[model samples]
Target: MTADTTGVNATTKGADAIDEAIAKGIDFDGTPIPTAKLELYTKVMALEANRQRSGVSNTMRSRIVRIGAKHIPQAELDQLLTDAGFAPLKEKEIAFFYGGK
Candidate 1:
């Protein structure tokens, strides 16, 4: 997903935003991502994609790291997600989380 800059807080860094989103289960999209999906994300990431650091699993591992970084709200996550397929939530959308959603 792409980071939707339109909704990001000018004062908050992307990594911090992402961190809050993950901790609070705020969907990057305006709509709420069902908890099941969130659980699934946890489960999927737990899978042993590779045994050796030598092949396809390594690629998967890298992708997982990028995904984690995105959630980590790390500065690098934005760059990685720029090349990634999903989009981030908008600023207005994030308000719902604080609004008692």
Candidate 2:
């Protein structure tokens, strides 16, 4: 099993494991987290098989930015994550991917 540099699950267990990680807010390292601290680390692999189906034509970073933005409408990406019962993206995480605000 290979680890995704993006910190997303890259094991060959199955798609369900990947989905579980996403739903539970776990990183590729299988770390149990995402509560008070906000940090966005998307499972890019999940979208690997569906990138064409989703009609996304941007680069990985751009796609991640879009995911952060689309997760919540009219609300800060981190705030939405926090509200969703998962850890929200911190300032650094936001700056790194979503740009500094």
Candidate 3:
């Protein structure tokens, strides 16, 4: 799964973007975060949001975050996803409050 310069999901193109931007130091808009970084965060947040919509458990959510954190700085990544509109909630705490499925 990948996206192109137009932000349309096209694995090779997106990978190319990552390689071009991050690996090669290409710049499109003078944005602080590279194009690849933005795309990476966007996709990760979207996936997490989809998982939430599907009712993935708190344990599962934490696992997902942990996995993501391995790829990038955890605290910054967490804030980035939260700011992008992914609901920040604890799956385990949710279970405690409302019970689990």
- The TM-score leader among the candidates is 1
- Model 2 lDDT vs. the true structure? 0.53
Evaluate residue 18 in candidate 2 and report its C-alpha lDDT on the 0 to 100 scale. Answer: 65
The C-alpha lDDT values of all candidates are: 0.52, 0.53, 0.51
Q: What is the lDDT of residue 24 in candidate 1?
A: 54
Q: For each candidate, what TM-score against the reference?
A: 0.31, 0.27, 0.25
How well is each residue in 1-101 modelled by candidate 3, as lDDT tens digits?
32223432233343466645443333443234566777887788779767745445555555546555555454565575577566464565334433422
Off by over 4 Å in 2: 1-66, 70-75
Clashes found in each candidate (C-alpha, N, C closer than 3 A)? 9, 5, 3
lDDT at residue 75 of model 2 (Cα atoms):
46
Q: Write candidate 1's Cα lDDT for 1-101 as tens digits.
A: 74444443433455578655555565555445578988887676567543345666556645555456435544344445446643443344334322243
> Model 3 off-target regions past 4 Å?
1-66, 89-101
Q: Give per-residue CA lDDT, model 2, range 4-96, as digits (tens).
A: 335355563755766666655666676655654324334445456556653333344344445666454424655655665555555566665
